[model samples]
Target chain A: MDEARSAVRAARRSDLHALTDLRLHFLGEAAHADARLRLMPDARDRTEHALPVWMGQADRVLLVGLDPAHDPQGPGADNAAPVAYAMGLLGAVPPVLAAQHVGEILEVHVDPAHRGKGLGDALVAILGEALIGRGAQVLRAAVPSTHEFARARLERAGFAPLQLELERSLDAG
Target chain B: MAATFASWLQDPARLVVVAEEGGRMVVGFAAGVVLQGNGWQIPARLGRITDAYVARPRRRLGIARRLAGRLLDLLYEKGVGTVRLAAAVQNEGALAFWQSMGWSDLETVLERAVPVEGRDPEA
Candidate 1:
């Protein structure tokens, strides 16, 4: 608990178990089905299956933050012990286009107890730097209006609203 | 340089389409996915058109329409009762195109920022 450094670094496959837990903690109850289908399966099975693949993908970058104050082990921190995390795609097409290489924020989540900390901001800056270094020209994020905290975080990180999608009732159609 | 888009599609969740002209040129393409339920109780599938492309010479030949229709049919077959897609705020022509195909607006997603760093202003 000597130095409190919110370092943003590449996430390792070993960290998937904890990341999945964090995702479930934040998104499990309220997230739509697609997210659940994508993230919340048998946790161990999915983590084991997806994490290694993710780590191998050059386009994907998983940034994690550790507060030495909380995780005293420094960089050797465990999967169940992340202070915060940000998962992003380096070359992505916004929802409006078919192209590629647009930086995209896939997921950014911090433990509820760590909400007020600047960990989210640090993670974003790290991700941005990594992305720009890898040739990302434009970065985009898709956040629901209901996610006030995430929306605020993205704006603070310098992202602006570029597109708005609407969904009509199937009954109406 | 390697085609980044093709390499990016390795994610199992993505829906992708591509057309190659007998190994000499690119022709047409489209892509989308059915979003069923991430957590909500909504049982219907929501189709999202992520990418649609057709070479200029292949335009006006019903390629895009067929591609879109094929995606829609795939969604229906997959048990998605409804589908949604988005367009840029200024993409009137694209908007018209979706409308022509029976897709419509959904909801507006907004953004706000949390201040970080620098000197705190006087209250």
Candidate 2:
């Protein structure tokens, strides 16, 4: 609600620690909601390892939402931290018919306390801009079918159902 | 497309099966590839059926089913324990086909186009 005290910007390498925390939080929530959800038990370690490479890549987009009221000194300050974040990757779309690029929103998370303040919307919008700048024609996101809240949030952001992915356990046979 | 097909045909991890009528005219084809699953869960080899098509006239002749079965056999020979595929929500025929073949519903992939123009001149 305090527009003057909140800001959203590209995440820096130093924000890796905060981003990792948020990623873990998101994964925890997802796994709690769905026992069938597949998540890395070592998600924190993987995020820490992958953030640097993602930060340095031009085709990758990472944005963090900051509450200046927490720490105005800037992102690396001891008290400064990201309350929400979004990450996306631009990928070539199989070069079928016409060469095209697609942006996949790999992760988007907003701290529970930070929800309802439109931070999630701002994060996705900025990420979409970044992807569009890099020649992405379409944006894709995969939300767990059981997560109605997440699905509604994406729909509010203009996403629509594209395809249904079906899988079967071959071990049953 | 021909070049892409040729290249895939050369990849040992990829399986491409084609059904030909009269031993010359191609009637149907199926393609799949083997992939390694991420280590988060069970470490299993996965197979994905990327594309399958049978001529419209050749649809009910069992060409598509035969091609798909052969492709699955090849993927199994390559050690793939799981297989996955996607079907457009509007394609009832395709959905029914996969479902009848014993594939279970997994997840839906949603998409949206980023507004290319209008709104926020400054991003």
Candidate 3:
């Protein structure tokens, strides 16, 4: 058995292929789900348009945890190679929101096989370090209302849920 | 719908500030949104107002009214059809402020919270 020593780092241009592979691994099969959510336009168009610009945005952070010992270096190591990852934008200091810089964790996922192995915790630590380096004092991980695993992770990481966004469609009436 | 309309009202193209007295202070500020889009498929252009905050001490001096009038002019210039805005459900003072300025509530947002795994379901 190989030693498991992984490194978590900021997304680089060289990581594009790897990141895309990871995205496709987790998200590729859900193509039809976009249409149902009316996110088809964003999925089909804006994702490609926004990735690099989003990468450049100051409040955005995309990170991956890589285990070189057990993982292959190329396309093969895309999602499978990454035991865990945390990707999302840093919150803008919007005048409306009093918080200065909130850490917005858009997506944090670990391979089911690798769960409980500290990969998720390591990824969070890396993301938290990256966020703190960028001047974020308060971190808010936006786990879905139904994600028990995510809630547990955040709570274990010392985060308490804060704000709630409630939305309704007027057209429904 | 109110949120959408509120965002529209804050559209930069519809909002403007007029500084009075050689630009020392803001005499009037108007906020609104455009409701018209391509072709006749959409209804008439709308220029909805969220707020027109004029200095309180400057009220009835036509500053507030003039600001509102100018905001309407901007909407007309943009070919807007219908305009709307809302006051908060509990903000009676703000409601009265808007009502006094001819605004009404067009929608309400209801919220319910559920708990799961010791986490706020709404968060």
Candidate of highest lDDT: 2
Candidate 1 accuracy as lDDT: 0.62
Q: Supply every candidate's count of residue pairs whose N, Cα or C atoms clash at under 3 angstroms.
A: 18, 0, 9
User: Over the stretch A36-69, how does candidate 1's per-residue lDDT look in tens digits?
Assistant: 2233345445545665677788878887776535
- Model 1, position A88: C-alpha lDDT score: 73
Put down candidate 3 lDDT per residue, A1-173, tens digits, no spaces.
Answer: 12232556666666665565565434432222322112232342434445567678877787776663454455656554454557865565544536355555666766556666666776766676566666554565654343456667777777665533212222222
Better of 1 and 2 by lDDT: 2
Q: Please identify model 3 stretches exceeding 4 Å from their true place.
A: A1-5, A24-38, A41-45, A57-59, A67-83, A96-99, B1-123
Report, in order, each candidate's fnat. Answer: 0.28, 0.66, 0.00
Could you tell me the fnat of model 3? 0.00
A best-first ranking of the candidates according to their DockQ comes to 2, 1, 3
lDDT of 2 by residue, A91-161 (tens): 88766577667888877888998887777877777777678777778888877667777778788878898
Better candidate number, 1 or 3, judged by DockQ:
1
lDDT of 1 at B110: 34
Candidate 2: residue B14 lDDT (0-100): 86
Q: Model 1 - which docking category?
A: incorrect
